[model samples]
Target: MPSPPSRVVAVVVTFNRLDQLKVTVARLLDAARTEGLQRVVVIDNASTDGTAAWLDAQTAAQAADGPLVVHRRATNGGGAAGFETGMRLSAEWFDPDWMLVMDDDARPAPGAITAFHASDRTGAMAWAAAVYFPAGGICDMNRPTLNPFWHRGMVTRTLLGMLRGRGRDGFHLTQHDYDARAYRAVDSGSFVGLFVSRAAIETVGYPDGSLFIYGDDVLYSLAMRQAGGQILFDPAIRFEHDFTTMTDADQRFKPLWKTYYHYRNLLLVYRLASGPWFALVLPLMVAKWTLKVRFHSGERGQYLALLGRAIWHGLIRRTQVDHAQVLEWAEPK
Candidate 1:
């Protein structure tokens, strides 16, 4: 009827990181000219560093070449919020058959967009993702390695613990450099080079804005899988990512109040994905966090203090406002 909204919508969320973000847009535009991407939406969080103005110029230059919508927010909303806003806008305006979520530091190898179309996102195949990480390198595009137990908020916790300081374990967005031979799917990955079909969006909807920060992609991917959407990591498609900005200890990692959302969302994801049985294990998670903070790192006391407050807030109330809110989200797969 209405042309079924281009089958592919590309959305990018950026903040003040103008220099880094420039790379992603250049790649997307290049892909559009060669591989033919139809629609793209970029949401710029209120950036004081002239990012908004620069984007304005970029959009004007590409307006005729591609249908790109650029919107600038009044203030910074964390990556989760920016992504939520971008996804919603992408679905409403461009409504591509497949939505590609790219981050400022991530990208695709040649034909990465084509690999998305080749995944066959029809009837049963609801979710189609690219392969991630080639070798010990940073994350690349993902493969179809769906985790039987897909949990968004927690995927990083596991991967981070394993990837922490592992010498030679370079970082990338898609994580494609890990294993380039086959395609697989795990729980989730950074938003830098994510590809989603319209069918999956119709069923999964936008990522939970309530998350406010981290864990949105993990949660979104889990929803797609539970809805019978297949998460594939096509080896042929390579999305590039430069994910070595900060560390977990960074207060601005998500936001100052990220200590709250990270814990709260962790509980939320575990509850939804794991079920009552898993939810009951929240206490153990808390305990482990406490121990890790104390014994694992010197910030034990501070970690416990902050984590305790977060646990109380998440467990006590249905919703809470975190004073800290800024745009930022990414991780190694």
Candidate 2:
């Protein structure tokens, strides 16, 4: 007999934030109930705190009803690795057709998954990309333009720009074309929360985890659209997320050297995902970091110096997704 259809697979990747993880888990379970979901996967990125222990107890208690599976990575895989791991395992191992990706801190409003799936079944759309921050966050994830060789072509363009030693600065971002209406096509993906389809996964592959951070989600969504998948931004779902909490955006857990990954990864994405004549934001960002560092970081020109060095590195170094090795900022190993 043919195999049964794949159910909704909710995958959450967590780090040291046990409190946020617990709340996210609770909300996901609630989502399961509301949507009759039966598959759930929680990948703990090796939290040194009580998160792993609590999950162990939950499993032992058998209180995690409705198809719950938890796996603990040996190390923190950062955001991209965590997302890739959870998705790969869920679809490959568990055989779920639909995967709902949630960040450690993202909590969807009631019926968010249900609403997304409802739109998918409409037969007009293929996939649904969920919210990010700034607005309610649970707004929409849209698809980008189509060209057979676009993604790879842009990658070539980036290499050429670097080889020619030209100045281009600005991360890749497409202007919003559609009116802010209920159903519209978009060119961005809110990685914080996204509802992806199995077909999309089969088409786009997984997010690249290298260069450390940023742009994996948007690239994946774009790839899906290129492969004939539709990404919906149903306004029904809502969530909350900020760049950081009481901590300043400029004041991160890591030193300047390692944080350079953001610069590299974003440049990589802009090069791979943007149209011809990609504009690099390195100049503006360098200036911004210079100010933020000169004033906010307390050391004159420390972070600004780091930013300048980062641009040099990004222009030359090549990186790709490495799911096995991850370093979480919250806890040192």
- Using lDDT as the measure, which candidate wins? 1
TM-scores for the candidates = 0.75, 0.72
Model 2 weakest lDDT span, ten residues long:
166-175
Q: Give model 2's TM-score versus the native structure.
A: 0.72
What C-alpha lDDT do the candidate models reach, one value each? Answer: 0.61, 0.59
Task: List where candidate 2 sits over 4 angstroms from the true fold.
Answer: 1-6, 63-66, 121-181, 226-228, 242-258, 279-295, 320-333
RMSD of 1: 6.7
Question: Tens-digit lDDT track for model 2 on 1-333?
Answer: 854433778888888888888888887777776775667788888899899899887777765354668989887767778888888998877676677777777766667666665543433223433344545332222222332234445545544554464222111222342224365444445565566766666677777655345556766766666566766554445554433432433454254344455655656555555445445444544554455554334533444444554566666665643433222321232
When superposed on Cα atoms, how far off is each prediction in RMSD? 6.7, 7.1
> What local lDDT score does residue 162 receive in model 2, on the 0 to 100 scale?
48
Distance from true position, residue 8, model 1, in Å?
1.6
